[model samples]
Target: MTRTAPAPTRRPASTRGGPVRQGPGHRRAAWAAWGFLVPITAYLLAFYAYPMYRNLELSLRHYTVRSFVQGDAPFTGFANYLKVLTDATFVPALWHTVVFTVVSLAFQFTLGLGLALFFARHFPLSATLRALFLVPWLLPLIVSASTWAWMLNSDSGVINAALGAIGAGPVNWLTSPDWSLWSVTIANIWIGVPFNLVVLYSGLQAISPAVYEAAALDGATGWQRFRHVTLPLLRPVSAITLLLGLVYTLKVFDIIWIMTKGGPSGSSTTLSTWSYRLGFGNLVPAFGPGAAVGNILIAIALAFGLLYIRLQRRQDPS
Candidate 1:
């Protein structure tokens, strides 16, 4: 019994080496990932991060065309920002920016949600109609602005023509100071609706039909179901949609520039347009002030983005 079995020998824990074998495959895979990321990292740094830093630097200094050319801009604390804040056009431009953003977002979201809901119904040609609606969003902003420019032109424009046909006086849409801002705002809304529709429609599709069935069983009517079930579920998607829409609308430049150039006594001048005016509009461009205004716009967009991030985390703690 004592000699029945010999004790098994225990193996050594390890040798002096940290890793017995370092795999070539794993090292190659890591290098491959770095290789793929390198170009994107370079592009972002070159195009976005570098430019933003340069612009911010320019904002804090007394920069000019000559200074820019010679690389010698004198540091001037917050004077440039002060100049922008005190400028007469600054207040009006800020107001126009606010009005344009608010009005365009309101109508865009409303019409887009309406279209999304309508298309959510599986009717004949629903998919086709939705695809066709994407034409506005796919077109270049220049082309869209040009088309609307012709449509909104004072004389011989389609819009005024329609008004004349309806016995209403032809309104100067782009030229009149009273209407220029609204005209651009309307054009922007038209351009933005298709994007919002696509996003919201996709969100709607992601929702389960079983939820609606449950709501119906609970005696919730159409509007009640939408408000209680659909809207609550759609909150996350809606937040992202509105957040992006706000940021894009705030930075709108091409439509305003192409259509009005913020014309007719600067009535339609938005913050973006005002920045352009300050920087390159004058013979002696005010680079510092222009950069300052641009930085302000960026700050606003950043604030909204941070808010969105905060909301997202709150909704999804994980």
Candidate 2:
């Protein structure tokens, strides 16, 4: 037929170029996504963002009990930060924090890696032993710290009694200035190892057994395989583990406070305990300086977290 076909209908330019009309299903999906997102956004704002803002405000103000309640605290700019930097406690607290974090991380990672490797063999009672090893980690921090305090007691402690049986002198673990940091550090190491073990063990389990078989067939010894294959594969997990441990160890206050109170002369006081002592451990609290110290700790953790993220990006092939 020579009759001209009817011209094809076309979408309006606005519909094509400006905005597409979403169907009911698309609208519902978008609403569902918002529904899922809104609660988390609200929660984060209420809990995390608001608290951080308040802390920052606190650090920048000269707040006393009167002013705090009245909400008339005067802003002092960076005076609080300067005061914290110049305070005599700053240097020692920073040093102690470094030592505590380093020693705990080193020992925990080493022991955890060793244990993970051992348990990877799937020996008899492996599951039982692994579960038992989680006791320190699973216990409440207060309970664990209290138990350590009692065990490390200078007088009538089981540790000292055991030392006595071995003809060794009893040492002041929690009381002495010389041993306070070390005592808390040992307790922290014990508490942290199980976490490291669980994480690293899971990482090891994700590794394919075929890789190990290939290494064995290529005449790679156990040490060689671990160094070349296992370690490389576990790099991502190890980085995250160490980063988390670093942040946690930096802010640890419960174990130190419960065990040693950062004392005999503040020898064991890290930044966290020092901050608490400033804020609430006295008759007249230095809220401004205390908040300043807390901000410093937060900054340190944030810096390390950023570094870890950057390193991860560089390591990621995609």
Candidate 3:
């Protein structure tokens, strides 16, 4: 009886026209996705791409203040880039910017991490306190810089008053080339902390409670739990926040401009402020060099962005 039964034939994968059918639904879904993306694509092309193209064009053009008025411009090729790179002022500005970015990133990240940790715990009045703490970031950049400038004024400023009370002499914070950069950094830190805190706090919230519970059950203390569980989980967020902070700090202009305007001796000039000074503020208006400076900044930011993307890819290979 077993031998007599014929083997059942296998059916083909397809019914009519093909082995496997992929119909209009798949094609429609793909078209719909492209349709959804069209608006943002158009916006980027119109705004960012066009502006960047124009800036690159401007970078190669030789246009002085007089040239701007008379509509007479000529191609200068890489001369602008050469001038910017060779300038003595540009070298010091670059050094100051690098130093400021490193030091400010350290302070902002450390302080922000502490604040994030503090706020991670469910404490009374934490929300209100956080709201109050964000006042520095909420304030306009010019206003915040102005306020710091006023406070740091050598004569009769609050800082000087405090110094007098503490028996420390009034320090010429902005007037001295030595302290002017630090003064800008301090104000920048105040503005930057809130952003870091918010980012880190959100990261902290994403950590699952069950993991903490499991750690506690395994006889882990708070520090141990945080070190093994919390810190590991927060690494991605930390990297993103730190990189973003670095980029923003690198592009800092308003605070430096408002606080020091390149200072009593050009000590506080950053790339952004230096670019503005070279391009628009000077009587002759060095447009080529200014655009070159801008291009340099854009390169740096793009580098950081690329690094972040690479890191993210490494972290999530799937």
Per-model TM-score, in order, reads 0.88, 0.88, 0.84
Query: What 10-residue stretch in candidate 2 is worst by lDDT?
Result: 1-10
Count steric clashes of candidate 3: 0
TM-score for predicted model 2 compared with the true structure: 0.88
- Candidate 1: what lDDT? 0.87
Show the colliding residue pairs in model 2: none
Q: Positional deviation of 266 in candidate 1, in angstroms?
A: 1.3
lDDT of 2 by residue, 39-66 (tens): 8999999999999999999999999989
TM-score of 3: 0.84
The lDDT values for all models are 0.87, 0.88, 0.83
Per-prediction backbone clash count? 0, 0, 0
1-318, model 1: which lDDT tens digit per residue? 000111111223334445323576877777877899999999999999999999999899998788899988899989999999999998999999999999999999999999999999889998899999999888888999999999998987999999999899999999899999999999999988997898889888878999999999999999999899989988887887787778778889989999999988999999999899888888999889999999999999889877766766665443
Location of the lowest summed lDDT over 10 successive residues in candidate 1: 1-10
Query: What lDDT score goes with residue 249 in model 2?
Result: 81
Off by over 4 Å in 3: 1-42, 69-72, 313-318
RMSD of each: 13.7, 12.9, 12.9
lDDT rank order: 2, 1, 3
| Candidates sorted by TM-score, best first | 2, 1, 3
